[model samples]
Target: MRRTPADVWLALPQPFLASEALAAGRTYDQLRAACHRGDLTKLAPALYAVHREWADLTPAEAHRALCRAAVSSLDQVALSHLSAAVFLGLPHPAGRLGKVSLTALRSTRTSYPDDWRRVLQADMPESHLTSHDGMQVTEGSRTVVDCFRQLRLRHALAIADAAAGRGLTTPVALQAMRQFQAGWPGVLSAERGIPLVDGLRESWLESASVAVAHELGYPLPASQVWIHAPDGELVGRVDVLWFEWGVVGEADGMAKYLGAYDDDPSPTAAGQRVLLERNRERRLEGLGFAVARWGAADLRGGGDGLARHVQEARRRARPEQIRCLWRQDLKDPLQEWVWPPPTRA
Candidate 1:
């Protein structure tokens, strides 16, 4: 029987056991052959999902299916590391994925971890454990710390920033969570990177761009800044502002241009977005700001080139005809930026 698109879409939600399939009139040999031939995916020892439908899922959604399929087979294990981070909706690199991350509660024994094929293990206390629809998972802060300790500095900073940006966790709490994995090789990155995270960053690329800019030895720039005209008219909320240098930097990701945030993903919509952005940039220039915009490709090669580009833009900056808001706390890291500025600095 030929399956239609609707059939696959409907089957997506029904992750099932091999026993269930056998009971539903599917032969064991047919199931085994389908899995071996890539027609189906075995999410756990006995759990299965349609391979085509599984591939259609976003990384987080796919991991969720993987977890639900495996949850009953594995006991005393809470989702940890990247698995828990994505499950809790933390900032993750788009389209990036890994196997289900789990940590044993009482002792280290598991079906997947025992085989060492599709699961990674960490050790966490029961206190850090939480439940999601009766399935064990790590708390947000603990998951952030676990993910941060394992990911690269730029990648880790995004998770940290999202956690802080939404008030999911604080720096102090992350510091406390670090103790669980203390003295391990990867813990140092989490410690060094946590303090550098800013809640004001609005995207993974923005967070990554800041990390790259910092690595290039430039002082951290104020982010999520609102620029105003001389007559008190609103110009725009710019991404990066170095008030002293009059350099305004923008990280232009595909989501900004490709209508990822809106219902339309058409090229016409993208072109319209670009035109609107150009108009916005002209307004900022009217306010006497030099704008530096870069996308992921510009910074992919370790940002040496992006640094030079920004420095060149800095050189083009004109004398401030209209004052732009810098983080009053930029010079003082201890004082946090209270989301909306009380008054211009």
Candidate 2:
């Protein structure tokens, strides 16, 4: 039986190129008709995927799929910046994947589809380039550095924290990259954030909370600290821990729990999870730690609001109420060696 274009696309591996389909004896008109019929989804110009498969992915995953599909069509370009971050499996702020970013070694007048963005940069050394699963992308250190140089401070810290948290790169490596970027725009912002990067930040919201805390002159907090009850029973792991302040901060993003527990898809499961969290908080409070909880609102409201909320919690933390619970040390060895360690003159 002769197959339809949609059938042809479904039969072939997903994210296939239009040229490949044409080579397989499928007419362009048929491919267009399949798209019109909503059987195939266009990932990029001339790049298509099975509609059902594409629909199953989250926005971030879909962005990654589009980037992977678009790479074959990109000429004289290597994925860099945010695109590299995504391709390298590094963390980045959540958003639409509006365009695929590429970096070229030299100036080029080559045109790409509207969805493709080319950055003509001559400073990308060969060492910074790497190939992952047949797709060329920037190395982790270079990718994080480029991201720091391009993104705003909050988002830059997010990328750096994610990179460190994932063990993809380190502050020392990023500092070395920064040395090469002297006099470059956003270099200072990048430098300021590199040392602050912590891989223990399990989520972007946690990273953002830390960034906001720093902006408000709040002493940096230890991440993922263990809370124990007076009887030595493990209470739970708290998000941000300030030992000296005897305060703990929680960066709550509903997506964290909801996304993980969506399999149940019932109010009962969600209520149970909420109750569990509340009980955990009560247990920590029972141990004499002043707990500060902020959700996506404080994070989105900027540093001032988050700082106020955190400060209020700190104020309420009385020395009499403070406990002497020992914090488990989970510091990264890389964090101890200072960036640009002092040199005797």
For model 1, residues 272-291, the per-residue Cα lDDT tens digits are: 99999999999887767789
- Candidates in order, TM-scores: namely 0.80, 0.81
RMSD of each: 5.5, 5.4
lDDT of each: 0.73, 0.73
Instruction: Please state the error at residue 340 of candidate 2 in Å.
Output: 28
TM-score of model 2 vs. true structure: 0.81
- CA lDDT of 32 in candidate 2? 81
Error of 2 at 150 (Å): 1.8
Worst 10 residues of 2 by lDDT: 332-341
Candidate 2: Cα lDDT at 193: 75
Q: Which residue runs of candidate 1 sit more than 4 Å off their true CA positions?
A: 1-27, 33-39, 42-47, 110-123, 263-269, 318-345
lDDT of 2 by residue, 253-273 (tens): 886456464687466777787
